[model samples]
Target: MRLLVVEDDRTLAGLLHKALTQEHHVVDVAHDGREGRELARSGVHDAVILDVMLPSMDGVEIAHQLRAEGIVTPILMLTARDGLPDRLRGFDAGVDDYLSKPFAFEELLARLRAITRRGAPVEDECLVVGNLVLDRRAHEVTRAGRPIDLSLKEYALLEYLMRNPGQALSRTLILERVWEYSFDSFANVVDATIRRLRKAVDEGYEQPLIQTVRGVGYKIKAQ
Candidate 1:
C-alpha cells in the first residue's frame, strides 16, 4: 500500500521512509504540514503518518481540515505531547490513532497496520476480479491460482486498477492517482508500465483482464 508521511524532522522522516520502504510499502514524504495536507488531499494513500508539530499548519489543523473536506483516509498522529487533553484533541481533530514520541519502531509498524486495516470500507484485505486475486495483506498476486511476481509499482498499479474494475480510467487519472503526476506528464512511463503489467498479469491467460479503451485509458475488465 502507498503511504504519506508528514514530518518536519528530517532525520526521523528519513528513518521512517527507509523502514517503511523495506517493509514493501510505497511511501511519499512531505516536510511541512502544507505539503502534507496537499498530498493527503490527493486521495491516494491508504494511510497517513502525521506529526503534530509542523510548519505552516499544525497536524491538528491538517487532520481537522482533511476530515472537514471528507477525506476519510485513516491518520495516525505522532507527537511528544502525551497528555490526556492532547490525546483528546488529536482524536477531536480526526486522528484515528495517536503515537507518543520516542516510540519503538515495532509499535509504530503495528499501529500503522492497524490503522490501515480500517482505512477504507471498499479496500478489502483481498481484491478480486474473476480468478485474478491480489492479496493486500500478503502482498501476493495470483491469476487462476497461479502465482504472479510483480514489482512494487506494478503491484500498486494493478491494485488501483482492480479497485476500479471496468471503469474507463483515463491516462491522466491513472498517472495522477497511481504515479502521482499531473495530466499527460510521464505519458510514456505510464504506457511502459502498463505494457509490463499486461505481460505479467495476462500473458498466458485465455481472457485478458486488463483492457485498453482506445484513446481513453485502461481498466481491469470486470468479470
Candidate 2:
C-alpha cells in the first residue's frame, strides 16, 4: 500500500518512513499540512498519517477539508492530545484511527493495518489481466503460471497499467503517477520504461498485453 505521512518532527517522520518502507509500503513524507493536503489530493496514496499539530493547517482541519472534498482515503492521526474533547474532534473531522504520541511503534503499525483494511476493502490484493497476474501483497507477478521477475519501477509501472487496463495513459500522466513527480513530457523516460516493461511482460508471449497508441501513450489490453 502507498501511504502519506504528515509530520513536522523530522526525526519521527524519518523513523516512520523507514519503518513503513520496511513493511513493503510505499511512503511519501510531508513536513507541513499544506504539502500533505496536496499529496492527499493527488489521489495516489491509499491512506494518510496526519499529525495533530502542523505548520499551515492542523490535522483536524485537514481531515475536515478532505472529507468535505469527498476524499475517502483512510486517515490515521498521531496526536499528543488525549483529552476526550480532542478525540471527539478528531472523530468528527473523519479520522479513522488515532494514536497518542510517545506510543509504541508496533501499536502504530497495527493501527495502520486496521485502517487500511477498512479503507481499501473494495480493491483486490491481486490484479489479473488475461494470463498475467500481479499480486499486490506478495509483490509478485506471474503469467500462465510462470513466475516473472520485475524490478521495482517495472512492477510499479505494470501495476498502474493493469489498474487502468483499457485506458491510454499519457506520458506525463504515467510519469506523475508512477514516478511520483512531474517532468518534461517530451522526455523519453516513459517510452524507455515502457519498452523495458514490454520486454518483460510481452516478449515471449504470443499475444501482447501492453499496447502503444500512436501519437498518444500506452495501454494494457488483454487481447
Candidate 3:
C-alpha cells in the first residue's frame, strides 16, 4: 500500500516515513496542508496519515473537501486535540480515524491497518498513459497494441509514473517508492532503471511519453 503522511513537523514526518517504508509501504511526505491535499486528491495512495492544524488548510477541511469531491480514500488524522467535540468534528468531516499525538507508534500502525482494511479505496486495474497501457491485474504492459516486456523494477517504475502522470517525480521519491533502500547512494539505481525503461517503452515509438524534467526528475504525459 502507498500511504501519504501530511505532517508539519519534519522530525515526526521523517520517523513516520522511515517506519512505514520499513513496513513495506511506499510513503510520500508533505509538510504543508495544501501539498498534502493535492497529493491526497491524486487518488494514487491507498491511505493517508493526516495531521491537523496544518498551514493553508486544516486536516478536517481537507477531508471535507475530498469527501465533497467524492474521494473515498481512507484518512487517519493525527492530532493533539482529543476532546469529544474535536473527535465529532473530525468524524463529521469524514476522517476515518484519529490518533492523538504523543501516542504509541504501535497504536498508530494498528489504527492505520484497521481503517484501511475497512475503507480501502477501489481503483481501476488498468493504468493508462497515452498509447501505453499497464494492466495491473494481468501484470502486463503494452504500447500501441505491442507487448512490452519489463523487469520487476522496470514495471514498478512505470506503474508509479503512470499512477501520477504529468507530475514531476523526484529521484529520491522514485527511489523510495520503487526500491527498498531510501538512501542517497541508491539514487543512481533509479536513473539506470529509467534508462532501461525508457528504451523499452519509448525507443521505437514516435512522440514518446516519458519525459526528463531537468534539475528535478521525470514525468510521463501523453503526446
lDDT of each: 0.90, 0.86, 0.86
| Candidate 2, 1-223: lDDT as tens digits | 7789999999999999898877777677889999889889976577899999999999999999999999999999999999989999999999999999998989988888798788375457788999999887677899898898877678878988888889998888888777766776544888888889888889998999999988778999954
Model 3 — TM-score against the truth?
A: 0.64
Question: Residue by residue across 109-210, what tens digits does model 3's lDDT show?
Answer: 899879877833345657888889987646689999999998766887898999889999999888766674568788889889989999999997778888
Put down candidate 1 lDDT per residue, 4-49, tens digits, no spaces: 9999999999999899888998788899999999999988688999
Residue 164 deviation, candidate 2, in Å?
Answer: 1.7
Top-scoring candidate (TM-score): 1
TM-score of each: 0.87, 0.84, 0.64
lDDT: worst 10-residue window of model 1? 116-125
Clashing pairs in 1: none
Q: What local lDDT does model 1 show for residue 51?
A: 98
Looking at model 2, the pairs that clash are none
What range of 10 consecutive residues in model 3 has the weakest lDDT sum? 116-125
Which has the higher lDDT value, candidate number 1 or candidate number 2? Answer: 1
